[model samples]
Target: MTITINTSEIPDTATEADRALKAKHAAMWASGDYPAVATDIVAALGGVLVDTLDIRAGHCVLDVAAGTGTSALPAARRGAVVTATDLTPELLDLGRASAAEHGLQLSWQVADAEALPYDDGAFDAVMSAIGVMFAPHHQQAADELLRVCRPGGRIGVLSWTPAGFIGQMFAVLKPYAPPPPPGASPAPLWGSGDHVRQLFGERVTDFVARERSLPVTRFADGAEFRDYFKRNYGPTIAVYRFIAGDPDKVAALDAELAALGDRFLAEGVMHWDYLLVTATRA
Candidate 1:
C-alpha cells in the first residue's frame, strides 16, 4: 500500500506545533551526553562515507545535523574543507573541542536541517551520518540537502533501518511515549530506499543504497546496555523521564527493551543495521 502525506495541508495551528516539536527535539538531544554514546562508532561510520564518496582533499563538504563532529572531523582530517551544522549548541561545542584536539580546522554552526543557513549550491558534497533523519520535517530536510549541494555533487546519508536494532528499540519504547504529531514522518523511513527516492523525487540522479552493520559495544551485557541507554541516550532518557510518573509503564518498557537487547546480542556485542545512501544532484 502507498501512503501519501500532504504537508501543504497542514493547518495554521501546525506552525506552533512544529515549533513545539522542534523545541522538544532539541531539548531531548541536549538532555543526555550523546557524545559518550556516539563517540565509539561515529568515526567508523564517517570512514564508510569517506570511502564510499571518495571524499578527497579540496572538496567542499557539509555535514548536516552533525553531532560531535562524527563525519565532519574525519572529512577535515582527510583534507576536505568541511562545515558542520547541528541544532544543539552543546554538541557543536563538543565537536569543536574534538576538532581542536585533532588539530583539524572545520567550520561549525548552529543550524537546523529543515532550514539550512547556506546558500544554493554552496557545497561539493553534503552528508548526514545518522542525523537529519530525526528532523520532523523530512521533506524539508531532504530539500535542504539537495539545495546546498552543487549540481552533480554527491549526497550521502546513514540511517538506521526500521528492522534494525535501534529501530526495534524505538518501537519497544513507543508505547510508553507520547504520540508524534500529525504529519511528522518517522525517522526510520530515511533508511528505506523507496522512501528516500520518494523524498528526493526527481531532484537527484544515480541513487544508490547499501545495507551495513555498525558495531555497538558500549555495554558489557544486555542489562548494562539497557541501563546505559536509559541513562545516556537522548530519546531513551526522554521517554523514561516522560513516563516516570507511571512506574508500571516504565518497568514494562524497560523489560521490553532489555528483551530486545538480548535478542540482538551475539557474543556480548550488538550490531545495528543501517542504510548507506548515495545520490548525485541532477
Candidate 2:
C-alpha cells in the first residue's frame, strides 16, 4: 500500500494569487514544459550550490520539495544520507523507482513544510530549490525549516531572479493570460527582496547572498516560447480556459504563441540569473 497527501484544495481565505498559482504550476509540474534540456539547466542551477553548502558524504540533509529527487537523488549519490519530503505522492513514486535503480536510500516522507513532523534540530542542513517561495504559509514554513536544522547547521534556497529574460518572458506572455492575483509568484519569493534579511535574521546567523549566471535556452522564436508559456504560466492557462474551451484552446495556444515570436526573440538566451540565499545558525 502507498500513501498520498492532497494539498490541492485552496483555503477560503487564501489570496487570489495563491489559488491561481496553485492551479497553474500544479498542472505544469504534473504534465508538461520545455525540453529536458531546460529542466537540466534548472537542476544544474541548484547543483552549483552543492559545493558552497558543503553537503558532504556523511551528513543528514532535508530535501524540501525534492521533486522526483532531482536534487535529492544527486545528494544521495554524493554520499549525504537524504530525507526527501513533498506533498505530491506520484512524483515520489518516480523518485523511489529511480533511487532503487541507483542503489540510493532516501527516507521518503509525505509532509507539509508548514507543519513538519520531525523533531527540533534534526538536520545538519535544510535546502529547497524553487520551493520555499510557493509555500502558502512561508513564514511558518521557514520557521519549520529552521526548527529541523541543527543550531549550527545551514539553510540554502535558490530561486529565479525576476527581471531580464525570465522576467521579460513572463511579461510578454502575461497579456495572453488572466490578471495575476496578489502574491501569486510565491516560490521565487525572495528574488532580490528584503524578506531574506528579515526572515533569516530572526532565526539564524551568518546570512549571505550569492549570484550565479544560469544557462537557459529561450524559445526558438517568441511564438515558440509563448506556446510553452500557455502550459507553464499560471494566468495564461486561466485566460485560455476562459476564452477558449479546452479542446480548441491548446491548439489555439500554439497559434497565438507562434503569432508573438517576433516580439520575444530575434535571438537571445532566456535570462536565468539565479539567486542563492544562505544562512547559518548563530
Candidate 3:
C-alpha cells in the first residue's frame, strides 16, 4: 500500500507542529531549576560582554533572554541603564533578588525574544550570553535584536558553536531527545559565523566574530562531568526525566555523554568553546 502524503498539506501541518514544539521548549526550560545550574557559568560571560562592548555609564542596555540577569546586572554595575528581559518569570524573579542583593537598580521584564516589547532604537547596546540562540524562530529573534538597538549601537552575543564541546553534547544527546520539528532551525546554527552573517544580512555593520573558550565545568574525570551535567543542567535533567521510563535508553545516553566528555576533559577541567559575535546596528 502506497501512502502518498500530500506534499502541500505538510507545510501547514509542520508550522503548527513547530509552534507546539516551541511551547514545549518553553515549558521544559520553565520546569527545571536553571538558575541553580546557569549562574556560575554565565556570570563571567556577562562581564566579558560588558568589556567587549565598552559599555559606558550613560549607555542604555537591553539584555534579551537575560537568564537571571547574568549580563544585565553586570551592565548595571558598570553604570548603564539596563533592562533585562526573559520569558521565564522564575528566572526573572531570581534576577531581581540578585540585583537587590547587590544594591543595583534595573528594570526587569518578562519578554519573548522574537517579539520584544521595547520601541525601536531604544537601546544603545543589546546583549545575550548563551541565551537568544534558543529561540525557535531564529530570523524573528535576530530581527528583534536589531530593531531594538539604536543606529550605531552594538549587539553582543555569546553562542555555543556547533563544533564546540557543548554543541557536541547536544549531538550526543540527539538520539535520546525528541527531534525538532521539520523546518525548525537548530539553535547551534547561531554559533556559526556564516549563519550569523546570513541572519543579520544588511541589518548590521562592523560585524565581528571570534572564537572564545569558557570553562563550563571542572571534573576529575569524564564520569564526574557526566554526573554533574545530568544532575545540574536543565536540558540534561529534562532529557533524563523524559526518558525515565526507558531505563536502557537512559543508560545508553549516560554512557554516550560520558564518552563524549573525554574530548573536552583536560587536567581536571572541561572547557567549552563558543562564538562571540558583535555588530553595530545599521
Alpha-carbon RMSD, each predicted model: 6.1, 5.7, 8.6
Alpha-carbon TM-score of each model against the true structure: 0.93, 0.75, 0.90
Better of 1 and 3 by lDDT: 1
- lDDT (Cα, tens digit) per residue for candidate 3, span 1-282: 111212242223235566566566666777656786676555567788889999878898999899888888889999988889887787889999999999998888877787776777888999998899988789988998998899999999989999998899888877787776665677888999999999999989999999988886556777777887787677787789879999999889878888888768876667788999999999
Task: Tell me which of candidates 1 and 2 scores higher on lDDT.
Answer: 1
Q: Give the range of the ten consecutive residues with the poorest summed lDDT in model 3.
A: 1-10
Best model per lDDT: 1
Looking at model 1, the pairs that clash are none
Task: Put the candidates in lDDT order, highest first.
Answer: 1, 3, 2
Q: Give the TM-score of candidate 3.
A: 0.90
Please give the CA lDDT of all the candidate structures.
Answer: 0.85, 0.65, 0.82
Clashing pairs in 3: none
Model 3's alpha-carbon lDDT is 0.82
Worst 10-residue lDDT window, candidate 2? 1-10
Residue 123 accuracy (lDDT) in model 2: 82
Model 3 CA deviation exceeding 4 Å by range = 1-23
Q: Candidate 2: lDDT of 238?
A: 54
Q: Assess candidate 1 and give its lDDT.
A: 0.85
